[model samples]
Target chain A: MISKKLAATAVLALSALLAAGCGSTKDAARPAAGGAGAEAGRAGVVLPLLTSPFWQAYNNYVPRMAKELGVETLPTVNSNSDPAQQVTDINNLVTQGVKGIVVSPLDSAAIVAGLRQAENKGIPVVAVDVAPESGKVFMIVRANNRAYGEKACKHIGDQVKKGKVVQIQGDLASVNGRERSEAFNQCMKANYPDIKVLEIPAEWKSDVAAAKLDGLLNANPDVKGIYLQAGGVYLAPTLQTLKSKGMLRPAGDDKHIVIVSNDGIPQEFDAIRKGEIDATVSQPADAYARYGLFYVKAAMEGKTFRPGPTDHDSEIVKLPNGLLEDQLAAPLVTKENVDDKALWGNSVK
Target chain B: MRRLRELALVPALVALIVLGAFVNENFLSYANIISILGSSAALAMVVLAESLILITGKIDLSLESVVGIAPALGALVVIPAASAGFGLELPTAVGLALIVVVGALVGAFNGFLVVKLRLNAFIVSLAMLIVLRGLLVGATKGKTLFDMPEPFFALATTTFLGIPISVWLAAAAFGVAGFFLRYHRLGRALYAIGGNPAAARAAGIRVDRVLLGVFVVAGALSGLGGLIQTGYVGAINANQGANMIFMVMAAAVVGGIAMDGGRGTMSGALTGVLLLGVVTNLLTLAQVSSFWIQSIQGAIILVALMIARVTTGRAQE
Candidate 1:
């Protein structure tokens, strides 16, 4: 019999381990300047781990942008993609009395309390990359995940006029995951009536993605394209699986899967270079540095911010909380423009 | 009743295949069957490892962490430092050996705490699970490792008579383990110890030693599984084994291994992994709504349990 005690322990252990990784590294907060003008208040910059080149570019740019904006950045903390721990770190920031915070939360819903705490305390917060569920955040500046999905779908639609396509969706719990899944499916349905969509929730796990993709490829050998939501995690396995099946080929090959992936990470760039995959949605790291910091500084200065035409190519819209959100430009990165120096992957070095 | 319970998994397997065939014409395809077996390879080892421990009145929650950390340690040394890795570039042979050593050391550490220190095995392993996970994140700095030599995936990539070598490795592990549990005296003592530790000790079965041995074996299995998993995934992320314990525990318990102690089979555990795999494959094949897939998986497990109980004429536990 499974003991009640064992069950309880199992649950507690899962919660604790799952909760541990988001990072509770409490950096001493910097105080805001007393006077206004360019002397904006000090802010906390919490980004995800810089292990991947995507975040490395952010790690490179955000603080530099903060300095140019005259905001003193606290030593950055890496959330490492655990949502709950991010809450702890943000709460720590709140307690440190930082005048403002710019956080790239791992999950949207899981960071509500952390954002709400900053809101309740009247500290301006700029949620970078992910928007919280219900928080009094001043602004959200993120890559439009829906647009990324649409671009991926359009890329696939361009490659294959009518055929089966697999959407290798990311983790479903996050806002990125949900939006990408919905918009890609919606785009495919609207644009390509003859294209059948098969959904595989690989959850950013390479093996799961590889295995599910293998099964689907085998079941439908003539499948024309694959839209992988997270390229950094999926590219390696996707290539390996395709190569093993003798299906990995450059675009324009008679029999090749027109693979379009999201997140312009270095791995995706390499795949694009090799022509093993067709394209990727480049979510520029500078968008976070520029817009994410701008709104935080504006909110701190007691000023209402509005998006401009030249500001990271973002369009302004009302967030759920009635605050204006700017959905930043996410460009489709193809092998043709893989060497674009303006892209984050090219700029990381 | 127990014998019937052990055999009940066979009909469940057949029924799932039949149901899958009815639902999807591609169900019986060579690719689909190979997909099921391929997916089951590494998981089967973890299931057998957990089964051996549970039957010996213990659990190793860190087995999953072992699966994550051992390969991570290997990768840390082999990958370049500029890429946020150590860049030691240890030879493939050394990396492979290190995987075994990491697993053995971690297992021995867990065994020492539970057996010698007389600490609660559950709590200790739970803590080790967290510590090892942390160590992995620290070691890799949350980077995903993928540049290992081709030999790293030899077991997964190569095939013997059109089946992956991973399937063969898993089979050999199951064969040896199943034979040992069914015939060997040392293996017999494991059940005796788990069934009644005090009685087993009085009867000179060396309960503590057998329990420690089970943990070591479980750890080594986890290491082998780690190699196979690394090969299968083709890359290792920092979060590799994050929620793997849930699957391992679920597989063993669902396969008729009593969570408390003292009963299970290789066939039962293999069936458990395959059933889970098949159900997963079915959901994708049937194009079941994504959100409903998890609920459907849970439902199938419950249905499988009810069938087992009905066939055995008693509650599974």
Candidate 2:
């Protein structure tokens, strides 16, 4: 009888937790269906993860861009940063009989199976943010991540001329993280020979970055500059750590650590205004959404394109994997251009 | 003998400190030691939570998720909608209380499933972990909350006697838990239950009630750990507690806690947390190639295990 009573109380608590869990996953996983305009050309978008503000911004833009481009899109399904789940989400979208699909892959190699399944279903897949290691996609919508590293190097190198600088990197196992780290190190070596780059493999985790960075700063307190790979995660912690140590001097101050970062989020803009950080390479979350739908729509229309410049400023380059990637422009945002009405971060809030 | 086993990791920790000093001149500085202690505070709290659950012969993987969702939910109701909060503007104290309450509630639910339903503890907690993680994503809409009230960041920011309060809290938690497990009657009852539930019940111990209480307290501890983590990180993100379970388990198992239950000490677990902390700090100070850090860290952990086997005079089996 006591067990039975306990079971009833358990049911009550489980339902409350499950009730909240049910609402969000349903909103995320449910494909848009039961439309009166069934023939209005529907596409499915599968997000890699929504944990990062960059992805959240891209998620917010999807429906608006789809409407602006005059295409009906199913509400996006978040894979929640699971490669296997991303594949399952794609198969489900194909089963729903959507005409086209847009996906930001969680893994470059694992996503090939999903792309292949979509191909077998005769649904054109537009890959965004991350390109598949090997797959046939209609178009890859992304910024040049290597250039993100190079731009940061130039920004910091121009000012700090000679000293130890730190680069708080993302997960090295990821292609984006590897490319950025390699390019930044190479740029520092070639352009600013006098500067030394100390790298922290932060794995896109803020706490790990902050802790290791604290240790790093302790060892080398006179470090001149810092390049944060992902500002969305690292910015606050980096600033917090620097402030605690009395190292977060303003830009014009003699002891300020000239900071360059990736991801031009609103927080980064505010930091730039306050002179906590100097510049950032906006990863073009808005363009990724706008053009991910734009290309998927073109594919649905049975359109074809060659590798070159498009009406939009982005260039289409054919990869050795027999895939085409439309490299979008990721502008460098500093104090001067931080308030520009054109930057996505400025427009987000 | 058991007390000596708990101190088994002390030699390994000293050796690592010696190695760290050799790697760099600044490695022995007062500032570096304080930084390592402060940063390891959250992990130490989590290790304590997991150790409590382990001591009871039941594992709770959901403690990791509790570390995230508890604090996220608390912050969500108080901050403005611009910060992705619900805009209730609840009192900061209430928000803090809500974090502990949510954690305790999750623990209670897990206890009900495991004890009342006779479900497998592993599967039930694993499922709860996933569910709680999803709830966090949904509650915060995957947006990182930055504009928390000042008190939310207090545990990490406030310092006493030249050390952060977070470090002191973790140390106190371990001390209290260690003393209870060693000397208190109820703490001895936990060992009796975990060693053999049927035998323990035959001895007139209220096994079910005590087990349920442990689960509840473990959950509350994890929630408090989450609160401390938020202050340490300076913000709360949906992925706050992601992958923390592995570290918690590592610290507990390495510290001499038996996975099968009924044998471990708080000192041993504290040693495990310190070992991992010192190794990470040493590698960074040595300027070891970042690519090689993970491999070297794994190797050191294996060596630590071998040392534990020698010190305890028994294999980990």
Candidate 3:
């Protein structure tokens, strides 16, 4: 009886594992051979991870934008935020004989080995969102993350003017986190001399943001404004905490704490519409996909870019690492332009 | 001696309370106290789960992933495809049940591997953690599920006698588990099994079945923990409960639960969870530099563990 039961349990466990394997592998699996663009040269797109809405939006736009640009691309492989897996994915893509690769690296320093391998294989790479610390790439398509901090600061500063404002920061270890935090602090010091910025480094976790924001509110009940570093994670928790404390007054109310956030997720736009937040810097997800494929396609055809102006109201700058970056336009969206048809968040159903 | 072990973390918690009082006057206020408990609720549940498993000479590192994927899968069933779900649009009640059920299923599978299949528990759980985390990212496609039905958020939003329901639920879980472990016959058998499975089997304690039951229960607890977290955060993101096992393990170890097995109390684990929560809230309220906050948290945990060691008359096993 014991042996029979043990065999049954083993079979059950194996089947369950197989079921989960099937369910999750559908997205990560390489597409079947001879698809619509089999004649066209293929580009491999590797995502850092899909845990955040910003990356998800970019992922959704990749195929559509690729079709529009007539670029044949493989089904994007997600590194799932593992630097080692990212390197492995790059190797796998190279082995598949892709003409070029587009990748958004999770860690700048750790991505070097992957880039080096692709370089050795002579497959050009177009990096999006995160620029690798040391590597060769066809182009880096990203917005000024520091400007994200400054724009948030100006919006909150213009409204709050003098009293204390809490800036819920992301992890200090990350480049985006450090840049946004330092830029926001410097801007506050330069532009609004009297405004006190209370900083809470939340490490990009919503619960941490909510807990820290809650405790901060308890001590500084008079905080006049709030700046959330990443609205994708922080928006709901911050709003819910404020609402629970009965401090989430409408935008025009005297007790309202002016809030500015980053990321252009639909929820942020909805919050702006409901007067829960004042403004957000709409990080251009559509532009990222457009240019990620655009440049990769260009690189595949032997076209090169230089440090200068671009036609899309942006600039291509050469970094200290000798890699060229096309800084895309990331506009600040307020209630006035929250409903703009061109903004990617507005288009998401 | 066991009683002393259970009470070892109390002094550290008390010291933290005193420090919090001095650091910020609002630290002891009723509202701030509730806030601390509310924030610690999810961590407390996962700690409780780990404590149960640790007492059985096992660990479930995948409990952290359970806290993410369970709710993500649960919410996915009720949401439409346009919202990044499978468009099942299942009833909210079924969706909620699915969270705990999925968690229990994962636990059951883990138990099968570690118990019947005789695989190494640590490696099995670690692999499960990676697999479940990947499943969460794939299933959600990296989108945060927002605008869920009101019942989903009601647990964290609603209050009973001025306390969030999640806090109440966590407190009840610790209470019930502590009572059972201390006084119940079957619970004592679990201790015996963890302490020495060979001896436990010789004593006819049904060692394997009890161990399997413990794993399933732990998984269910983890699932409920995720549900409460979903309500607390107001939405489910693919990254929920990411890297939380470190905190859960730290709290369990600091609370005097033995990694080698067969020792510790639910009260000890609960205090461990509270100590971390209090320190985090105090640091934030004190306006400590964001960079120093993590370093300070680590130092405090080390000091607490030292205190536990001294009081227990030995280092934790």
Candidate 4:
């Protein structure tokens, strides 16, 4: 018992020392005055995780854009999609005294503490991709998730005009999940009346999605199409399940299910161009990168923008509460247009 | 524990069934029962493994990671070199062999730490859990591997006697484990060592060897569970079995497994697995809000724990 206590105490002491070392190093890293692009100041970005390509794009993009903008970017810290870790990271960034913070919350409601901490600290925050359910943000720069859902619905609807369609949901606690699911169901009912949509809530985990998809496929062998809310997690598993069941092919192969998915990941792009699957709604990486940092800089620089169709060459929408939102339009990328140099998929590899 | 306390689980199961039927008329149908049984296979395996370890007065927190890394290593070997894979492309037989080896190796590592080094089983296994999970993420690069051979999924996709083979795997694991626990010398030694290791050792029982073997069997069962989960999902994901430790432990505890050790029945653990599974499916079929599912699960575990503690005449909490 004494030895075990000593071991635990030693580990705790080591951790405290390491944390203190990190704090001192960050404090010592305030660069000299009048450096080029130094006016942009040092900033911190807290992302969810790098598990999916969609998140990896944002994680890789922010640092690159910060370098171009002449701002000193601290090493991007991810919560690994844990809400508690997100709160800790945000608190650490605040302690580090970053001029601005760009955050993509893992959960809308669970992120209130971190956002409130930033608000208390007077650090400008830009919410990327996902908006916080509570707490104030200087601005939100994201794609229109509802718009992406509608496009997926139309793509699958056009291909399979009268059959069962499976819609695999992401984490429904987030704004993206609710919007995409509701929009798709509504669109299918309004336009493709013959299509019967079966909803399976997979909660952003590939294994969960795969198991549910496998079961659904077993029960309904003739299911015509599948709409994956996010491809970064769902794409590989959905493809694998289909392949095991001998259902993967080109547009008119022996058994082909019209696969319309979200998140234009690099692998999905490869799959699309290879004719293994249909189109994917490409959420703009530029929106996550340049636009996210743009809002942080604007908020820190005391620039105020309002809700409108377009604001200073950027698309803007007036939110219900008169809050301004910079929403980018997503495109349906297929094999025909997979070569677009500007697409995030081409940029990844 | 009394047989009456054990028999009490039947009412809980029936209550879930009754509630499920009231919520959705199709819940009692043949198709939904099959779905429930199929989904419970992996969980049942996990609970069975936990029952062994818990009965031995030890806990293996790394069982969940064992489930993930075991199958990942199995699939990684067969992945063709053309797609940034390891390129071994071993035969299906060799791939399955790799999974058992990895599982045994992990179990041996845990046993060495706990028995040989006399470390706390809980802490050692917890660290092993983190390390193995990290290794999985690094090995797979957080990418799901679907390029595994066709036979890898046969355990889940195939049927015998008109039911999924996966369900039979769970049943067989429990049946063999129960019989072994009741009749085998080494298995009986597990109870004696967990109840009092020093006394068991004085009684000429090889306590450490028996305990180590128990962990090994637990690990292999967990590894098999991982394989079953991979087959059921029809894909191998890096994040497989993440956060599964809590569920396994909860089932064991609810089934009247004493956390302190040396007291739990295979049937009780099995009942816990079934009860939890039915409640979850019932909630999902009832269309309860997604956000409340976690809370509801916690509430069910708490309720079951209280009932078990009251019936067993011990303050488990």
Candidate 5:
């Protein structure tokens, strides 16, 4: 009887634990206010992707900012990474009488219709991280991806005098990848005429990048430099491959290879300091959240706004062109000042 | 004749190896071979677990989700101490023990639905698959769980006696599964159940009990697979075993395991896994485009199934 009771209690405890586990941090990040408008109480804000650290930080800061502003924010499910899902979420928020909606578009094209739907329902929509191609979005807050790409390529050019350079690109379908690759290619063509850029698609995967690197090495044995756009998660395996082939080294080492990657993830910063990589471009994740919320707030006020440009800070403030662009400036991280915490601290946060 | 039939997969595997060697010299390198086996080990474990269920005339579409969930659960137990929360950091042994217990519980749940509720295995396991996958996504917030214990990582990357730890683990799992299906009365009972459920019942075998046992074994092995996989990749993601069900099923079918069930060996399953791994390795070594890999995998499976079916038909005639 005692054993039976014990087992029953254990099962009860486990079931409770499972139930608790089901409530994700993303759900907890929602605004606590009950209704939509400021007068109606608190409102909910949903993000498109929760898997990425950048998005998670976005989810975290949005609610924290909402709380400080005395507003309620609720995060809805956009887990599918589908524009239809985002559209549905926007419509649902509108039905719930939400004062405003902040969305990071899954597909720039598909979200245009969704934004129009929200607009039709009189719901203000602020685009975050990525902007819709349609001019309907109130504001787009994001890092300057093209400048980031240019800075990354320029850094890589500084490392190698001339030879074959392999560009490890992210998913080409993504707006960030396309813009970054374009900027990198533009910089390469303008400055490094002797350097040959072989764009090898890594698909934003470490193993894939490593495999591609192996093939690239086998095909082009004398490749002197690599420009990686996706940061450490997709760089580790390639770095290991290079290490195995005796290509990576510190300042005094016999062989030196230039690596300029993006998304200054913690490990990438460590790599830069250790000289395994030459430099990296840091995307301000916290700024994405802070500015993303500012855009939502501005939209909610029924203020006239222009889409921001990719090169300058728009935040909630008016821009020079009175247009809000989705891309922001890319901060460069090099071996000379990798220890500067202020520059790369936002990425780790 | 049974022994020869069992060894039939060997020739195809040998032929593939020779073809690979001729196609690419790098395919014969030690590094490439080790990499192939290492990559295949996780999939091999999934196939082994599915083989047990197939032996009992049941299919588990839920094996994929089970693989996804186990590592998430294991990660929860392992990563929290180092990261988010402060708790007693359990060793790999403890983590594995918890994983097995959780797996068995899930298996028993599946068994209960099939036996007591009398749901179709196909429908029941598929539902479980979706439910578990949803739960995994929600629990991890779709982010990967990293920073696993060092020992667990070692289980994936380390070698013992010049053999990868994963290869050894696969071999041991196969040996144990083969022995269970051969010597044990319960194992024999499973085969009887798969061969004919009505006859099994008439022969005084409790079909429900045997099925419950089969599911328990399948789930336990899936748990083991999850543990190995987490160690293999050093992280767990929501889609860790997504699209793996088709691969597991194909490997089993190609290994002479009939779709109708009661017709395969653990040894054949291993050979099927190794054969597929070798083909993939060869393609990679030859610098084949990624787009061709999936099509080639499909073609190999079709050819293997044809050969298996023809050979089986001839023996029956």
Candidate 6:
């Protein structure tokens, strides 16, 4: 009788185990089916700085474009502008099983390990706006900043005739800053050799630029031309200071101080029109987002992608030949073209 | 004589106003003054929040992180699809509520370490600061959140009755905070704890609970400040609260809040904020370099602290 009872209890336990297994399978399948039916793929995007208007515009556009593409983009932004956070976000995205990732890295070099970590997990990363220093990402989509710099420099060089040019550089350590400064300096040296370049690091801060400019102005009162790599907000105080010091008006009938800036923010545009600023290179806000999404889509689909050589280290990556080069078609806006409402309206004062 | 020492900030404030007015007619202009008040409002709220924690003889070095995370969470909530996922569409009010709740939760966590675990407030808050900063950086992926609805942006730039909405909100916050600090039983308990923790505990006051409550209140106020700051800038970035801790602490100290705690009035904190704002405005008008502005601000804070210390010492003698 005891042997019979033991056999009966074992049979009952086996049936219970099978039922429990079936129940769990159903539970898991239900969510999987539901998730598939939602028609949305999860993508993670990492940006360098959230507070900047450039990044802000980029963040706003990515999600909107992702929605249109029927993908849900989860943007994980770092407030401290730290690369470690970028690595952590990538790892987290990988663990969460995201379909793809788009990152605007703070330090391109520091994020290589993180990108490798993601790649190890079979997750594809799309470097957006800012390319990573090492590793082959699925794709890199960024504006041709060097070309933009060259164009900006050429425009300023064309306007100025034999004057000391002061270049207000962004953060020297930043990839964007370094590339822009290099391109601008190279173009100035090649095309306008007479224009002496006095490069000062502004650290991409308005206040810092203003202070540095003050010292620069004090030292180089005869400096007549200024090329700023960033937006025009920081240049306002400097210009105001110059105006106060009676250095704004040219000795002759000319715009005395030729101020050229990048990032055609609304205030900059307005200043250009008012003759407070000379010109600004228009960096369309929508372009940052649209390009980011395109790269992300290509990455997720395993399609080969590459940005402009000026924007990325293409030769280092040994990209396949015949890839369409990405270029920033940034139109130079001066007082003459400042009234172009279609493009200029997006500028934030 | 003690009352005079408490009122010492008023004469200095008046003198600053007179000096500023004499220096530049634009200083008294409606637009410039409004701008000053608008900018100060956010910092003032931060100071007020810190003041609450200060009164309880504890410091929250994590305030900057609290400021960053709360607004970020608010942004996450207001994202239309976030509501659908969570099955709740948080309106601005609801979003703000969520921010405060999360802030309170973080504050409670800090309080748990300090009050329950018996850790040093400074060290605990500092750790919390780093953790929250990391979380903010991780959550946002180093990007900023913008494109807030027009109504939300209006909260930052809109003017109500010749005053910016932010300034009005700050005033309301200060009034309420001042009333609570002056009259509420819990407020009194906080002061008592700051004055003498052991004596207060012996007198049947739940010292731990009061300290925790102070942190929670401070966190809630900080959450509100974050919302205001995000609105004011029309964007929420990862560095939203970077370098703000120093300003808040300086304002509190300059306002005559004792470092050892158990002292200071809300009005004094406001005075301190106003003084900083005025100095900044003057420098801007003077077209001073940004580098000099920072140095000058540091100097002003030092001078104010020195003056307060001297006055307090004289009063004691």
Off by over 4 Å in 2: A1-40
A237-273 per-residue lDDT for model 3 (tens digits): 9998998789999999989999998999899999999
The list of candidate 5 runs beyond 4 A from truth reads A1-44, A65-72, A80-84, A109-113, A131-135, A144-261, A270-279, A305-324, A335-349, B1-19, B80-82, B137-143, B179-186, B286-317
- The parts of candidate 6 lying over 4 Å away from their true place are A1-349, B81-92, B309-317
What fraction of the genuine interface contacts, i.e. the true contacts, does candidate 1 reproduce? 0.44
Ranking by TM-score: 2, 1, 3, 4, 5, 6
User: B100-139 in candidate 1: lDDT tens per residue?
Assistant: 7888889889999999999999999999999998899778
Error of 3 at B174 (Å): 1.1
Stretches > 4 Å off in candidate 1: A1-33, A37-39, A48-53, A307-310
TM-score of the A-chain for all models? 0.86, 0.89, 0.88, 0.85, 0.79, 0.78
The candidate scoring highest on TM-score is: 2
Could you give candidate 4's per-residue lDDT for residues A99-183 as a string of tens digits? Answer: 8898888887888888877777667788888777768788888888889899999999998999889898988767899899989
Question: Of models 2 and 6, which has the larger TM-score?
Answer: 2
CA displacement after TM-score superposition, residue A46 of candidate 5 (Å): 2.8
TM-score of chain A, predicted model 5, versus the true chain A, to 2 decimals: 0.79
Looking at model 1, the pairs that clash are: none
State the C-alpha lDDT per candidate. Answer: 0.81, 0.90, 0.90, 0.80, 0.70, 0.70
Q: In order, what fnat does every candidate score?
A: 0.44, 0.67, 0.75, 0.15, 0.11, 0.11
Cand. 4 TM to true fold: 0.81
Query: Better model by TM-score, 3 or 5?
Result: 3
Worst 10 residues of 3 chain A by lDDT: A24-33
Q: Kindly provide the TM-score of model 5 when superposed on the true structure, using C-alpha atoms.
A: 0.77
Per-residue lDDT of model 4, residues B1-317, tens digit only = 45665544666667667877787776777756776777778889988988998888989999999999998988888878654357888888888888878888899889989999999999999999999998998887666676678777777778788667989989998998888888898778878887998999999999888888888888888888888888777667677899889889878877777788887778888988988777766665554555576688678767766666555565552
DockQ of each: 0.38, 0.53, 0.53, 0.19, 0.12, 0.09
Tens digits of per-residue lDDT for model 3 on B236-257?
Answer: 9888999999999999988888
